[model samples]
Target: MGPKLPPARFVLKSFMAESGLEPRLLPHLRVTNAVEGKVDFELDITKDHTNRLKILHGGTIASMVDLGGSLAVASKGLFSTGVSTDLNVTYLSGGGKIGDKIQATATCDKSRCQYKTSIDYRLTGNEVGMTLAYTSVVFKNSKGELAARGSHTKYVSKAWQAQSEAFTLPEDADIAAEE
Candidate 1:
């Protein structure tokens, strides 16, 4: 049987096509899978993403995983606004090169008031084989993988204050006010 589609899939799909988010977050962030509670994504490794070690930069992996989790929760529309309270990652392997596709899977786990999430990233190469580059990634690392293990907590917030959903910000909000 085919995978079940999430109610929010169309909204996210429209957001991607209309918002032009791919170029902003590296082409790899494009969503390849969007199920009821999960998302699958991929990124092609390139010189632009390499670090001094000539492998996939840890930061890139971190960002990908973080975005993956965010997208997962956003799919449900469970919270209006949210922030990563903590993020932990474990780098098991690394690879880099043009045309190298790295896949990542993200899921949301809201067991308590906070949203617990996790992401797993994998890189596959004909020469390097398949390697696990990241696991249990959050906004930052330190809490460690075992602690995360497909379950980490975050604080979800309201997206709107007293303004309407379609309300626009004040014209001078972007500019500094003179005394």
Candidate 2:
């Protein structure tokens, strides 16, 4: 089959399109593959994303970790990936210099983010249900060497949240793709 679920990158791309920092900084990011709970991508390092040493910057890596986690959550069919609860990044290498393509894959380590249940709860019950998502990312250099790794957590328990299914559909999905 083509894919088990619709690629969530479209939603992510749309978000990036509207984001302030992402629009200027992550201009070169490309979603190679995206499915439920997983997202693979690549980026060509440029001077804007480098350090004084002319290699990938640590801040840039950190930013990618945040984005990767959001993308992973999006893979599970969530548009608003929620707020970051935690984020960690370990730089194994410099990734690469300008013009070098850095490949990365982010996988949802744990996910129970249900769109319908994200805000669902018993009004009378004092106990609240738990819904969260965790994602891990591995970055590789052009030579296939380990460049960096990271982990991220997102809290998607949208209290008083309101959402409609039609708000997140891709153009193709709402058109003839369903037939």
Candidate 3:
């Protein structure tokens, strides 16, 4: 990398706050890394996330693909809001059991004021290399994984350079905590 950039955690947090997703996913979503055109996020599969087969639910995987890809778009500092235009996911393996770790990695292709992002995700169990899910989301910002991945897209708005003029956070804001 030529030079490191700000983490997407703040951007995601902002989105979460504005969209009121904190109560839903803040406990699980974590920005592992964010810089330039790359963003990484992860979630641990818990008892609350299991499905009928006692496996990680498909919905959880889709969440990953949405959030993961959005981070990539946010990191570019282009759009304040990244609206998912489309999404696509694929399930390679079952996310069996609880206490599993699911990681999503996102990369971007930047243009004038927009970014095209793709997120690749994998879920791992304690011992077994559980393919809990594998997915790729072509997101601009709106959402998250395989266990959801096919074709996802979004529309993003540019951010203000001035902190004072930057986006505002809501009362029950998730991004506020990160900012």
36: Cα error in model 2, Å? 0.8
Q: Give the lDDT of residue 98 in candidate 3.
A: 74
Residue 97 of model 2, lDDT score: 93
- Where is model 3 poorest over a 10-residue stretch in terms of lDDT? 126-135
Cα distance off (Å), candidate 1, residue 49 = 1.4
- Candidate 1 regions off by >4 Å? 1-25, 78-81, 112-152, 159-179
Model 3 misplaced stretches (Cα beyond 4 Å): 1-6, 109-151, 157-179
- Colliding pairs, model 2: none
| Per-residue lDDT over 1-179 for candidate 1, one digit per residue giving the tens place of the 0 to 100 score | 11323323333343445555434546434455555346665566777666876666766776666566655654433322245566666665443445565666666643222222222212322111011112233222222222112333344433322213312223443211111
In candidate 3, position 84 carries an lDDT of 64
lDDT order, best first, reads 2, 3, 1
Residue 10 in model 2: lDDT: 63
Measured against the true structure, the TM-scores of the candidates, in listed sequence, are 0.54, 0.80, 0.61
Q: Which candidate has the top score in lDDT?
A: 2
Better of 2 and 3 by lDDT: 2
Candidate with better TM-score, 2 vs 3? 2
Candidate 3's TM-score: 0.61
Runs of candidate 2 exceeding 4 Å displacement: 1-6, 111-129, 159-161, 164-168, 172-179
| Clash numbers, per candidate | 1, 0, 26
Candidate 3 per-residue lDDT over residues 88-145, each given as its tens digit: 6767655445766666666654333222222221232211111111224432211222
